[model samples]
Target chain A: MREDASISINEIQEQIIREMARLDDWMEKYEYLIDLGRDLPPMETALRRDEYSIAGCQSQVWLMPRMRDGRMNYVADSDAKITRGIIALVLRVLNNQPPRDIAAAELYFLDRTGLRSNLSPSRANGLAAIVKQMKAAAAARMNT
Target chain B: MVFTGTTYKKINTAQVLDVDKVRKDFPILARRVNGRPLIYLDNAATCQKPRAVVKRIVDFYTRNNSNIHRGVHALSERASGEFEAARETVRQFLNARSTREIVFTQGTTDAINLVADSFGADFLSKGDEIIVSGMEHHSNVLPWQRICARRQAALKVLPCEHNGRLRVEDLDRLITENTKLIALVYVSNVLGVRNPVEEVIRRARARGVPVLLDGAQAVAHFEVDVRALDCDFFAFSGHKLYADTGIGVLYGKEQWLRILPPYRTGGGMVQSVGPERVRYAGLPLKFEAGTMHVAGALSLEEAIHYLRKLGFDSVRAHQRRLMDYAEGRLRALDGVTVYASPSRRYGAVSFTIDGVHPYDAGLILDKLGIAVRSGTHCAEPLMRKYGVGGMVRASFALYNTRDEVDALIEGIRRVQELCGECKSTRSLQ
Candidate 1:
C-alpha cells in the first residue's frame, strides 16, 4: 500500500495511464497486467463464498469490501487470469480512498489504455461491472 | 454469381469441395482482424452469408419492395409471388409434405416457443409430461419448462451419458401414457453429437406421441427429410444455413396444424372478423401474425440454392474431415480435454484446456483474430452434465478448410503458453 493517502484519484489515474503508454503493443501491456495480477495478495478462502460472487461474468468473480480507518478498500478475485489482471488495475486506482472519493472517482484509465474496448460489451460483467459494484459499495458506506 | 453446371464441376469433385473456391464466395472471409486474417469458427452460433444471399437481399428491396399477400398493384403481386415461392423453396429444402405445412418464424427459439405454446394450449393439462433430452440448448429446454410450469404439467429429461451422447435406450422407458410430446435436438450445438432422432421419432410414433426435432444445427451440415423421419414437427433458423437472421421454418403435419389454434393471431392470418367472433386463416397463414421478414425468406431461398449447388454430400464430407482433424489435433495436446467423442458428430467440437478458464482462452484467441464461442453456449444443463463452467467450441462450416483448423491448434498453444503459470493458482470453486 502507498503511504501517501493524500494523492488524488486523478494523479493515480494519470500515473497508471503513463505506465500503460510505455508499453509498445497489446501483448506487452497484457504481460504487465498479468504480472500485476500475480503480485496481488490472494483473497482468503473463507471470504471467497457465493454470497460475494458477481453474476453475469463468464468466469467466477468474488468481491468484498472493508472499511479501514474510514477508508474504503476492496478485496476481489477472479478465476480467470485476464479478469484478475483487470480487477488489479481497477483496485490500484480506487483502493485506500475515502468513501466519497471512491464513489465519485472517474475511471478514465481503462478507456485511455484501450482495455475497455478489449472487453466485450455483450458480457455485462467486466471492468464496467466491477466499477459499478465498487461505487455502489462506497455509496452504501456514505449513509453510515 | 449464378451457379451453373460448369460452376458445380469447377468447385466440387465427387465427394470433396474446392474450399478455396468456396471461400471466395463469402467476401467477409477475406477481411483482416487484429492485424491477422480472421479465422471464423463460430458456425454453430451463425454462419457467414455468401454473395448470392447478400445480393438477393439487395435485389428484393430495390426491385420487389412491396407488402406481400395484400397488395393489388404489380409490385405487390411480384412480391407476394416471390414470398410464397420462398415458402415452396423451404418446403422442398426440408422435404416437407406440402408448402402449407411450413410456417415462417423468427428463429429456432421462436419456432420452439410456437410449438410449446400452441401444443401446450391444445393437448397439455395437469400431469401431462413433455420429454426433452438433457443436451438440448436453452431454446429447446426453456420453452417446454415454462409451458410445463404454466399448465401444471411435468417436464421429464432424458439424460445424456458422461461423454455427452443421449441414451436412446432410456427413451422407451421414459415415455408413458401421460407423455404428450417428445422434443429433442437433431444435432447438439455444444457437443456436436447427432442425437438418434430417427429412432426417437419412431419410438414416439409407436406411443401415438408427436416428435419435434430442433434442426437449427442440423440443416447447415446435412440434409433433413421431415417426411422420411416422420417427425411431427421440425424447426430451424435461416441464419444457421447461410441466410439472414429473424427468419426460420416450422414444419408441422397438416392433420395437427388443422386442429391446433394459431400461435399468434393478427393481420393476414384471418379469413374473417365479426363483432361476435373472429375466424382465423387456414394452414400456415394462421401462425404468421405480423408483417413477415420478406427479404429474409427470399435470402433463405438463395442460401438453400447455394447449399444445393455445393451439394450436401460434399458439405458433410468436408465438415467430417475438418472435425476429425481438429479432434485428433486437440486430443494430442498435453493439457487439453475434448468433450463428447461420439462416433457421429457435426458442426462443432467442444473442449477445455486443463488449467485455463475458457473465457481467458477465448479472449487470448480473439486477440489473435480467431473467433470462437467460449461460454456455456446457452446449454447450461449440458455444461453441468460435463461438470464444467464452460468449454471452448470451434464450430465449422462448409467454407472452412484444414488450414484454418491448424491455425486454431496454434492459437490454443499460444493461449496455453501465455496463461500457463496461472493454472496452478486458478480455481473456480
Candidate 2:
C-alpha cells in the first residue's frame, strides 16, 4: 500500500464512523444516505444519459465522474423519486474515498437502516452492483 | 445526442437510431416516460409492438374478428382462415412436423403448464423424476416443480457451470430411468448465457427421458428447428419474438400431442359432447381450449416478418458487436463486475457496482435517457446462487449500437462517484 494513500483511506473511515454514530434512527440515516448521493457532483448533460443504463431499475439515472488526486469524484442524478434517495445514501459514504477504502466500505449502515433486509432480493442485488462499481472505480484510480 | 461526461467523447445518438423510421415502428418507444424519452430495456418482460403487429390486431378486430372452427359467419370464416394461416407460419418457425403439432396458449408460462398437466400428469408417476437447469426462467422452472410435487416425484436441477453455462455432467448425473422429463431455457434472461440444449436433450433421449426447451429468449435472438434438435416439446411467447403478448406456442411431437389429454376442457376443443363424457378432437384442437387469441396470433405472423426483414442471424451478430462493446467498455471501467463470460450468448450482461445499489444505478441511467433493468430478474434462486441479491442487467435488441454502449460506460463512471466506487468486471475470456 502507498504510504500517502493510507492516510486518506483512514480519513474516510473516520468520517463514516462519525456520521453513523451521529445519526439516531434509520429514517435519519436514510436521509443522510440521500445526502451522500446529493453530494455527488452533477454530471454534464452529455454524459449523464445515453446508453449506460443497467436493466431492471425502475428509474432513470445519469452518472459521471472525474479523477481528482487519484480518487474518484462522482456526479449522478435520477429521474425516479426513490432511486435518487438511494443514490444519496451511497454517495455520502463513498465519495472522495480511495478505491481500497471504498471497496472495503461495510454494509453495517445498510443493515442498521434495514434496507438490505427489506429489499426484495432483486433490489438488494442492485445495491450490491452499485457498490461494486464504485469500489472498482476507486481501485482503478489506485492502479492508475 | 447521447449524454457523456467531459472525460469521454460525446456520442451523437441521432445518427445511431433512424429516429423517425424506427420510432414509427414502435408506437410506445416514441412516448415519454417520467418526462424523458422512453428508452425501453424491458424486452425480456415483453416487447412493445411494431406497426405490423398493431395493424394486424386492428385489421382483425375491425374486419374479421370471430371464433375459430365452429363459426359459419363471414367474419368467422375470415378470422378462422387468418388464425389457421398463423399456425402454419408457426410450424415453419419451429420447423415442426405439421401445423397439427403446434398448440396455441396464453403465453410461455401457460404452454409449459399445459404440458406439465397433460403429459406429466399422465405418464409421470410417484417414482419418476423431472430435471430442470439452473438457468431456467421462473416460467420454465415452477411448472415442473409443482408437477413433481403433485406426483410425489423428485425435481432435479442441472448446476450452473463457471461463466453461467449449464453443466452437462450435472445433466447426466440427474438423468436416470425414472427421470421422465428435462425442462430448460435455451438462453438465460438474466446472464444471457446459452445452454447446449441439443446435446443435453440428445443425452436425455438416449436415456429415454423427454426434454422441454423454453425458447422465449431464444426465439428472438436465434434460429430454432425443433425437428433437428429432436426435443420432445418447445415453448415460447410471441411477445418476446415480436408478436402480441397474449399469444405463445407449445410445439410437441404429433404422437405426444395425440396421446396427452387436453389441459383445459371447454367449448371449441371437443368434437362431440355427451352428458357422461365429451369426446375431444385430435392433436392441436385438443390442447387449444376456449375462444383463442385469434388477432394476437395474426399479429404474431407480422412480428415474424419484421424479424425476417432484419434477418435473425444478422440481428444476433449486430447485438453481439454491441454486447462486445458494452462488455469491454463497462467492464474496463472502475467498479464494474460483469456476471457472464464473453461467449456466443444472447445480448445481456448482469453486473454490480461497489457503492451504488442496482436500483440507484438504474435511476441515474434513466435520468440520462438510458433505460435498464435492475433486481433479481425473477430468478431469486439464481440470485442466491450468484450470491448477489440482485443485479443490473443491460439487454439489447436489433437497434442498439456502439455509441449507446459507450454512453452507458461513461454514465456508469459518473454514477460511481455518487456511490463511492464503481467495480464493473470485464469477461475474462
Candidate 3:
C-alpha cells in the first residue's frame, strides 16, 4: 500500500473548510490533510519541467490546473509521492469551486483525514503551503 | 491477468522452481490474504520467509540462542560460531576475500549510514563531491547528503533517461577528481531501472573515487558477487533476501574498512574503555557496537544457501518472464502507464493507472488479496524526472507465478472499471 494513503478525496474540501472555520485547532487536524493526499490524482508527468514546480517542498512538486467546464481540473506531480497526494487533497475542495467558495473553504479537512495526529510540525507547515497554493489557484481562477 | 509468457517459460523450464515445491517453503504464501489466496508482489520491499530460514531462526532461539563472543559458556560459543558461520556464508555468497569484510547492521539503511558516518564524513571535506544517481532510495541518498552537508562536500546527481536507464556518459560528466565517492543503487525500487554498476565502478576506480552500491532490491533478484562487481562498498537488507529483519550486510574492501572509523562505539566494539578514551576491536567486531543479532545472522546464512540451491540463472530468467508477462498485461489496460523496458528491467515493474490514484489502487488491490507497493517509492527525484508523483510497484521473486500475475491484472482492471473509462487519463507510452 502507498504509505501516504492516510487521506481521501471526499474529505479534502470538508477538512479545509472546517480548518478555516477553526472548529478545532488546525493543529489537531494533520492526518485529515494527509488522508486528503491519499486520493490526489498525481500531476501529469508531461509538465515535469521547471515551470510547473512548487518551490521549497522537501520534495519537488509540480502543479498544473486546467479549466474544464468552468471548473478546475488539476494535473500535478511531486518529487515526493505523498506530497502529490497532499496536492490532490487540496485540489479536491478548492479546484473549480467558485472563487469566493474556494477562498472561503470553511472546513479544515485535515481533521477528517486524521493528519494532525501523526505528522511532524514541518510536514504540517508543508501542508499549509500546499493549501495556500490551492487557495491562490482558486483566487486566480476567480479573477479569470 | 498479470501473467507473462516469459515468466511462464522461466517457471516451467526451471521445473525445479515448481510452484508447489517452492510455495511450500514460504509459510505465508499458503495463507489466505484478504479472504483469497495471498499473492505477494512486494518482494522488492521485503520477501516472505521460507520454512528453512524461518525454522532455523526458531530453532536457534529454542536450542542455542545466547549472546556471542563475550561469554565463554557453551551457548555463547555455539551462537558465536553459528553467527560468524553465517558471515562466512555471506562471504561466499558475495565472494568477498574474508568474512571479516562483512559487518552486520540493522538493515540497508543502517549500513549506508555507517559509510556516511564513518568513511564518508572523515574523508569528504567541503567542496569534495559525492556522486549519486536520481533513482536512489532514501537509504542511499540521504546519508551521503547529510554527510556532505556536514563535511562541505558537494552532492552531484546522474540523471536517468526516458528508459529510466542511467548511461555511462552521465556518470562520466558527474565524476571529477573531487568526486570522493560515487554511490548508486543496484536496482531501482520504483522504475525498475538497472544501473551499469560494473562499468561505473571500473571507471570510478581508475579515477580514485570510491563506489558504494545500495543492493537492497538487486540482491533478491540477481546473483550478487561483490568480488566480481568489485564495488568498494555494498549494502543490502536481510528482509529483502528472504531472511529476518534487524540484520543486514555492509561489505567493504577489507583494506579500506581497516582504516575507516567505526559507525557506533560502545561496549562490544571497544576492546577496553579508559574513562576518556577507548580502543576499538578488530575488523567486524569493531563495527558491531552491541550484543549481536545472533539469530538474524544465522538465518541470513540459511537464506543465502536457499538462494544458492535455487540457482541465480533460473531465478533471474523466471522473474524476468514474470515481469514481461505482467508488463504486457498492464499495458493492455486502458489508461495504464508502465515504464522501464525489458532490456533494463529487474524483477520490479512500477506503473500507474489513469483514473485511480496509487493509494486507491493499493486499497482496492488489498481488498482483492494481491499485495503490491504504491507511492513515491522513496525516489522522489526519479519520480519527478518521470513526470509522476508516485507509482504502483509489483516486484517478483523466485517463488512468484503466472497465476499470481493474473490475479494482479484482474484486480487492476476491477479498480480501473470502478474509476470508469479514463482514456483522458491514459498514457501507456
Candidate 4:
C-alpha cells in the first residue's frame, strides 16, 4: 500500500466504501472491524507511554507518528480490539500520504460508510479526535 | 426451555419475584435495542420507574399541580398536604423518629453537599479532621474534600482491602481527637460491597464523631433503619429508588438539623424576613427553600409504597440470589476476573475480562441489548486501589431475572471471541 503514495484520497475512500458495502449488517461490520483490529500491529512497549496516549476515549489509544520521504506515517494501537480496528482503517487511508493532502482531506467516507453513526458516542468522538490528531500533525509539518 | 450451563443452575423465577410480571410495570423495559429486547443491568446507575411511580407523577401534574407551602388556593393546599405526606412516608420508610428529620434536596449529592457546607462551616476549623473510606463515590468524597480545603481541616481515608471491602478496624486507628466527622458510603456503587456500617458507626460514636451514611446505593436493595444505625445524617436519591430524578432525602438527626445553619436561604426557608435580620423556618423547611420537586416528591411516595408492599425480606433474598447467580456464571467464564468477592453483596457485581477492554466489552454488550456500566463508576479512588483502568458492572433489581444473567454470560463470551484472537495473517513490518 505504501508503494501507492500517489493514490488520491477520493480513490482510497471509494475503495473503503466498496469494502464496507460487502457487509450485509451491523454484526458483520462489527466482526470485520474486530478482525481489522486483531490484525493491527502490536504497539511497542516503550511507545505505550502517557505522552503518546489519547485521553478522551473510553479506551486508551496510543499513536506514534513519523515523517519519511515527505509523507506522514501513523502507527496506532488500542486496548480495545474494535477501537484498534477503527484506527487501522484510519491509518489505511491517511498513512503514507503527503502532509498537505492528509491535512486537507475531508474523509467523508466515515459518514458514507455509516461507521460514524454506528459506533458508540465515545468511540465516535475518539474517531473524530484521531482524525484531528492526524490533521494537526499534518498542519504542524506544513507550518515548519 | 430451561437454560443451564456447567456450574450454573437454573433459577426458579417463581421462588423470587415474578420478573416477567414485574417487567411489565416498566414501559421502558419493552423497548427494543438494536433489534433485540432490552436487558437493563445498570440498576445502580438508575432503576427504571414502575407504572405506579410514573402514574403518580402524571396524576400530580394532571390534578394537584401547584406550588407547595405558600399558595392560598385549593391546589396549593392539596399539593402541600401531599408533599408533607411524602416526607412522612420517607420518615416511616427509614424508621426515622419524625418527619421533622427528613429534608428534601435535589438528590443524594445535593443532600450530602447540604450537610457538608452547613456542618463544616459551623463545626469544623483549622486542623480538624474528617474520615472517609476509599470506596466512596466521587459524590461522597468531593463534598468533604471541599469542606476540608475550605476550613483547613485534614481529610483522612479509612482504606479498603485489595478486595474493595473497608476494614472497620482501620477506622478506630484513623480516628483521632481532631476527627470532627465521619462520612462514608453504606454500599459501594462499583464493587457492590456493603460497608461495615455498624462497626463504622460504633467506632465513630466511641470517638463522639458525627457520621453520615451515603445510602444512595443501599436504599433500593437493603433495609436501612436510621434509628437503628443512629447515623447523624443519611442521604439517598429517589431516582435510584425507582422514583423520578431531581428528588432525594437528607435524613438528619433533629438535633443536627437544628444546630446547623441554613444551607441555602430563600422564600420557603424563611419564617420572617426583616431588613435587619431573617428568621429561618424549622427542621426541613430551613433546608428545602424555594419551590420543590412537587411531582417528584409525590412519585417518590408511590415508589416507597411499592417497595413496602413488595416487602424488603423477599426483595433482599431475590437480589442476593441474583448476585450469587451472576457472580458464579461470570466466574465460570475463561480469563474473567470478578472483583469484590465479598460474602454478602446484594445486587451489584463488577468484573473484567483478559485481553478485552471494559469499554470494548460494554460496547459489544450494548449492541446485544444488554446495558452494563463501564469505566470507574465514579469511584476513581477505588479503581486506582484495584490497579485497573475500569470495570464492567452489572447491577440487579427486583425486575432483573436469571434470564438476563444468562444473556450477559453469552454476550461476554461473544465479546471474548470478538476481542481475543486475530485470524488475520498480516504482521507488523
Going through the candidates in order, their DockQ values are 0.42, 0.07, 0.05, 0.43
Q: Give the lowest summed-lDDT range of ten residues in model 4 chain B.
A: B1-10
Candidate 1 vs candidate 2, DockQ winner: 1
Indicate the TM-score of model 4: 0.92
lDDT of 3 by residue, B1-429 (tens): 123332332334434345557778888898986477888999898899999999999999999988988899999899888988899998888999998899998899999999988987478887899988878898888998899998888888887778876877777677887889888998888877778899899889888888899999888777888999989899999998889999999999998799999888776897888889888999988899988788888889999888778776666666776677778888887788997764757878999888556755664576578899877788888878888756888998888887888889988887666444322232112
Clashing pairs in 4: none
In candidate 2 the C-alpha lDDT for residue B154 amounts to 90
Instruction: List model 2's recovered fraction of native interface contacts, to 2 decimals.
Output: 0.12
lDDT against the true structure, per candidate, is 0.87, 0.73, 0.75, 0.86
TM-score of chain B of each: 0.95, 0.91, 0.93, 0.95
Candidate 2 segments exceeding 4 Å error: A1-33, A36-144, B1-24, B421-429
State the fnat of candidate 3 relative to the true structure: 0.00
Model 2's CAPRI class is: incorrect
Model 4 per-residue lDDT tens digits across residues A1-144: 345648877788898888888877665667788888776788998998887887643677788777888889887887776777788888989898888888899888888888776344654235556777888898888655
Report residue B195 deviation for candidate 1 (angstroms): 0.6
lDDT (Cα, tens digit) per residue for candidate 4, span B1-429: 133432223354333354566778899999999888999999999999999999999998999899999999999999999999999999999999999999999999999999999999999999999999999999999999999999999999999897767888977789999999999999999888998898889988998999999999999887899999999999999999999999999999999999999998788998899999999898889998888998999889999998777766666776877788898999898999988778888668899999788888887898899999988888989888888988999999888888889999999988887776656442222
> Which candidate should be chosen as best, given lDDT against the real structure?
1
Off by over 4 Å in 4: A1-5, A49-51, A64-70, A118-125, B1-16, B422-429
**In what order do the candidates fall by TM-score, top score first?**
1, 4, 3, 2
State model 3's lDDT.
0.75
A22-94 per-residue lDDT for model 2 (tens digits) = 7664434444455544544555667755554433334455555557786677666664334555666667556
Off by over 4 Å in 1: A1-5, A119-126, B1-15, B422-429
Q: What share of the true interface contacts does each candidate keep?
A: 0.34, 0.12, 0.00, 0.56
